[model samples]
Target: MATERMAFDDLPPAVLAGVESHAGEIVKAEMVSQGFNSEIAARVFTANGAFFVKGLRADHKRVWTQRREAEVNPFLRGIAPALRWQTEDAGWVLLGFEALNGHHADYSPGSPDLPKVADVLSRLGEVGCPDIELRHMEQRLERYAAKPSDLAHFAGNSLVHTDLNNENVMVDGPAYLVDWAWASRGAAWLDAAYWVVWLMAAGGHDPQSAERWAGRIPAWQTAAPEAVTAFALATVNVWEEIAGEDPDPWTAGIRDASRRWAEHRKAA
Candidate 1:
C-alpha cells in the first residue's frame, strides 16, 4: 500500500503557491524517507518556522486518509504533533504539521524508549472517541475473525491507533504517536495487543516478554485471557492476507511474528 514518492519541487506551481500561502515562503525543504503512507513527505523551513508536510493527489485511491488524519488531529494535541494548516489545491491535498523534533522510537529490547512509548499508549486510552466519522475495530476485523460472534471482543467507544509499527512512534523528551489515518474506535486493550506483535518483530522479544511489557499499559490489565487469545489468532489471519497481497519484507516479518504469537497463545 506504499504510495510512489514525489519530490517537493516536483509539485505543481499552484500547489507550491498554496503551501506558501499558509506557511509563508519556503526557504528549504528536505524529503523524509521513512514513512510509507504519504506520496509527498518533507520537512520545510519557512519564514514562519519549520513544519512537516505530507500529501497525496486528490485522485489517489488512498486520499481519504489525508482527510481522516486532519479530522482526528484535534483529539491528539499532546499525543501527536499539532496540525498547523492544511491546503487542497491543484489536484493535491496537503497538511502542514508542527514539525516535531525527535527520532522514531526504538522498540529494541531493553531500550529506554520503551517506557516512553508505554506512557503515550496509556494516555491515548484516556482520550474520548469523537463523534466524527471513524471505523470500528470489529468491523475492520470481521472478515478475518474465527466467527461472527467473536467480533464483540473488539467493540468499544475508545480511540485506538490500530497501527503500532515502531516508526509510527517518535521519542525525545516526550514520546508522540504519528499517523492517525488508521485510528479507529475499539477496545482500550487492543492497542496493547498491537504493541506486543511489534515488540516481537522489531525488538526481538518473545511472546512472553512482549506480554510482560504490555502489562505496563493500564488497559492491558482489563483484557480477558480468551479475548487476548482470540486477538492473537485474528492478527495472524489479518497479516497473512496483507503479506499475501504485498509480498514485502516488512509485511512478511509482521506475518511471521503474528503467527508466532498465535502459536504461543494457542499453547497457553
Candidate 2:
C-alpha cells in the first residue's frame, strides 16, 4: 500500500505560497497516489493551466535528488515532462512541470504499451550522454559484478534512466519517463536491462520472453551477450541485498525475478 499523499491544502504556508507563485491561484490540487520518491506529488490547478508540483523538505536526505531532476530535465525533451519552475524556500524544495494527463504504462504481457515502451527505450538509447557529472553505470554495478573486468562492458556515452519501474512511466499518447533522480551515464542498452527484470517480476514474461521484448530495442539487440548475462546476475545480487535490508513483497519479488533471469542465463 502507498503512504498518504500530501494535498495542496495541507501544505505549509510558505511551501503553499511558493507553489502558487510558480503555478497560479490554486483551483484544485489533486495528489497523485502513486509513486514513492517525492513527499508531494500533485497536480496544481489554476485558471492559467495545471502544473505538476513535486517536492520534499529541504532538510530531507534526498533533497539533492531535486537538483538531479532539475539538472537532467533540459536534456530530457519528450522523454520527460518539461520543467517549468523550481523553488527553494521555507525548508522545502519544489519543482513545477507541465502537467501530464496520463496513467502508468502497463508492462504486463500482451499490453499494447509494450511497443511504445520499447520505442522510448530505443529513442533514449540514441541520445549521447549529456556533459554533466553523473554516477557511471559500471561503478554503480561494481558490487554485483562477477568479474571486475565485467564492469568494463557497461562503459558508454548514452544517458540512462537507471530506474525503469512501471511507476516511472506515464503514457497518454507517448510514454514519458519520470522520477529521474537515479539517472546516470552508461551503456546504451542499460535501461532496457533494468526493464527486463521488472517485466519478469510483474509476471509479464519469463526470462526468455522478457529478453525478446527487450530485443525490440536496437541497443539491447547489439549489446554484448556476456554483458547482458552479467547484468542479469548483477541485478540478482543488487535486489537480494536490498531485500535483505528492507524485506518486502516488492523487493523480494524483484530479487526472485532476477534470480530466475540469472538461472536462465546460466542454462543458456
Candidate 3:
C-alpha cells in the first residue's frame, strides 16, 4: 500500500529538530511528487546545504525498506546519491541523502540518455553483492517460473537495482540509479533484462531494438537463451499480477509490454 505523503511542516517536532541538528534549520522544503513508497519525500534547504529527506514511522509495516536503503547505500557509491545521515526519533525513521540536481532519465527512442543508462548498468554489474540481508532473485521469481528448475538461472552474487522505472534513473551528464529500496542480489544480467521491458514500455522500442540495447552490457550477453526466455515468461506473469492488483495506466502499460516481450522471445 502507498503511504500518504506529508509535508515538512506536518512532521513531529522531534523529527524536525533531529533534521535541524544535522543539517541546520530547515529554511525551505520542496516535496518531491514522484515515487510512491515514502511518506515524506522532499528536498530540504538548510544553512549547511540542500538534502533530500525521506521518512516513515519506525513501526510502519514497510520500515524494513528504510533499513535496506541505509544498509545498501555504502555499496552504491557513485551509482546512487550518498546517504548523509539517518535518524530514528519521534517514532519515525528518516534518511537524509545528498540532493541531486538532475532530471528523470529520458528513455524515449533516440534519447541520448539511453547510452548513459546502459553505461551505468555496465558499471553496476561489476559491483559485488555486499554481505547484508537482501532478497535473492531466484526466490523472488520462483512462483512465477514455469518450472522450479528455471529459478536456478536467476541466481547470482551481483548486486542489482531491480526497479528500472525511468523516474528512478536521474540523468544529467551521466545517469544515476536511485531508489535502493528494491536492491537485490541477482544475476548480473537480470538488471539488463528488466531494463528491456522499460525500454519497450517507456522508450517505444520494439523487442528487437530493446534487445539490441541490452546487448550493450556484456553481462546481458552472458545470459543463456533459455534463461532469457524463462525470465521473459516469468516477467509477463509478474506484470499481469501487478496490473491486476493495481489497475493503473502505468501498470497496464508495463503488463502489455511484458506480454509483447514474452511473445517476441517465444518466437525467437
Q: Tens-digit lDDT track for model 3 on 1-268? A: 4688989779999999999998898999999999888999999999999998998989988889999999999988889889999999899999999999989999898999999999999999999999999999999998899788889999999999999999999986789898888899989999999999999999479999999999999899889999999999999999887888667887889999999999999999
Spell out the clash pairs found in candidate 1: none
Candidate 2 weakest ten by summed lDDT: 1-10
Prediction 2 TM-score vs. true: 0.95
By summed lDDT, the worst window of 10 consecutive residues in model 3 runs over 241-250
The predicted structure with the larger TM-score, 2 or 3, is 3
RMSD of 3: 1.1
**Which regions of candidate 3 deviate over 4 angstroms?**
none
Q: By TM-score, is 1 or 2 better?
A: 1
CA lDDT, every model vs. true structure: 0.92, 0.87, 0.92
lDDT of 1 by residue, 110-207 (tens): 98999999999999888889988999999999998878877999999899998899889988588999988898999999999999999999947999
Residue 151 alpha-carbon offset, candidate 2, angstroms: 0.9
Q: Count the backbone clashes (under 3 Å) in each candidate.
A: 0, 0, 0
Better of 2 and 3 by lDDT: 3
User: Per TM-score, what order, best first?
Assistant: 3, 1, 2
Evaluate residue 56 in candidate 2 and report its C-alpha lDDT on the 0 to 100 scale. Answer: 82
lDDT of 3: 0.92
- Cα lDDT tens digits for candidate 2, 1-268: 2334566577788877877787777788888877777888988888669998888878888878788999989998998999999998788889999989888989899998899999888889988888887899899999998889889988888999988899899997999998898889899999999999989998859998999999999999778889899888888888888888667888888889999999999889
